[model samples]
Target: MGELGEVPNQLQSFRVQDAKCYCCNHSHIHPHSGESLPCDRQLVYETFKKWWSAGAEEGSEQHLERFNTLVRQRVAPKVARGLGIALPFHYVVYMAVFCMVPWLSDFIALWAETRDHRAAVSMWSLRHFIAWGIVGVALLFALRMCVWLWKLGSRIEKRLDSRWCAVFIVAPLSFFGVCALWLPIGISLAATPEDNPLPVFLFIAAIAITALVWRAPKWQEPLPSKQPSPHVFQRKEDNATFSI
Candidate 1:
């Protein structure tokens, strides 16, 4: 039999491969109080495997939990910074944009009202400003799409437990209280009645897509099935024939 005592080392076994967080300079130290994650789900899985291999010794349970927490604390942050320009971080940027949306609309409305010379201006000038606004929106959307593709490339789709996936769907927007999950639905409903509902519809669609992504059922590998040996089958058949 294989040596049953070759237990895993708690200090070194299940953790992130990297020395420190990609964002934070301190890898060895915790990020907030300094630490948990990225060494995350994998750590949990590896620990389970170790425990199974160790003959499920109950004493090692504490060691598994302790090491898991210690390693995760090293990667975790005190507060969500939403720093990366990539998929996970960009969700915050979208929230920031959502908060600004009303403000931007007000500014535009005030600008239109204050323009006492609108009646005197040519349609050509008005078209130019409208064109610029469209271009800006388009560019913002393009950037978001590229980052989203990069996020998918991170293979987070397979590892749905990634920090950016589940909670982030609601966390960032929670700042405005009602804006959490309600904001997207509200935007779509409010804008759908308007003449130009394209952007709001698009946002709503994006939220739906992300919803499917994060909430999608997690699939675990099925256990291998065992088959009886050919000799066992042959003996059974022989016994059955004789009995009959």
Candidate 2:
């Protein structure tokens, strides 16, 4: 029988050999090619071991919750910052382009109002300047909203009972859903009977494609139990040993 507070040799060996990334559970070695990839397993395992030893029960919900909280405190901000930096680029490229579709007719009308060649040229340039300005402002607001949502997610994660920590994921989906509905309606309202319906179709297709293609940030859940069985940590009265 093992001494109190000592992990069994079998369990310790299993943990050491488990190559799955402790954070995301992504395997470090390619199954087919046998190539090794880098992951957060080293740091995560060290943290896990530290907390696991401190825990009153090896696999209890309270123990897991505390471990998750510690991980989030260390990791969530980095994830949030990464999303904040990366997502805005997608929003500027995809959302901004589709969003400007409704105003296309208005821009053309602004050009047509001045038939004089020089005047039309100046008017067209002015229209572009105004349009781009609006887009820039909108993009700023969108980026700010992303920041706000990440902060909100952090707050939600801090709550003892809350488990929803993917506000960044929700934001893009919500944005796309709104655009999917709004763009078609806007086109219908702004366009005449003779105007091409292609923009409407294109807008819907673009929203669908972006939603599918966009790789949103994923929050890693608490690592699953590595213990071979519940009995690994169960107190044994006859042997007077507590193995983990």
Question: Judged by lDDT, which candidate is best?
Answer: 2
Candidate 2 yields a Cα-based lDDT of: 0.45
Q: Give Cα-based local distance difference scores for all models.
A: 0.38, 0.45
Please, what are the lDDT tens digits per residue for candidate 1 over residues 1-244? 0111111122223332222223223433446765532533334447665654456554334444444454434422211112222244367457546755555564466456655554423332333233233333433444444444443434443457565663455343233433333445445444443234444445445456545644443222221122211121111111111110
Question: For model 2, how many clashes?
Answer: 0
Cα misplacement distance, residue 120 of candidate 2 (Å)? 9.7
Ten contiguous residues minimizing lDDT sum, candidate 1: 235-244
Off by over 4 Å in 1: 1-13, 16-68, 73-123, 153-244
lDDT of 2 by residue, 1-244 (tens): 0121122222223322223332233355555676774555445545666766554555443433444444344444444334334345555667766877777777777667756666446634543434333443344344444544555555455553354445545467548754554455455434634234444454445445445434444332233233333222332122211112
- Quantify how close model 1 is to the true structure by its C-alpha RMSD in Å: 19.9
lDDT of 1 at 114: 52
Q: What's the TM-score of every candidate structure?
A: 0.25, 0.29
TM-score of 1: 0.25
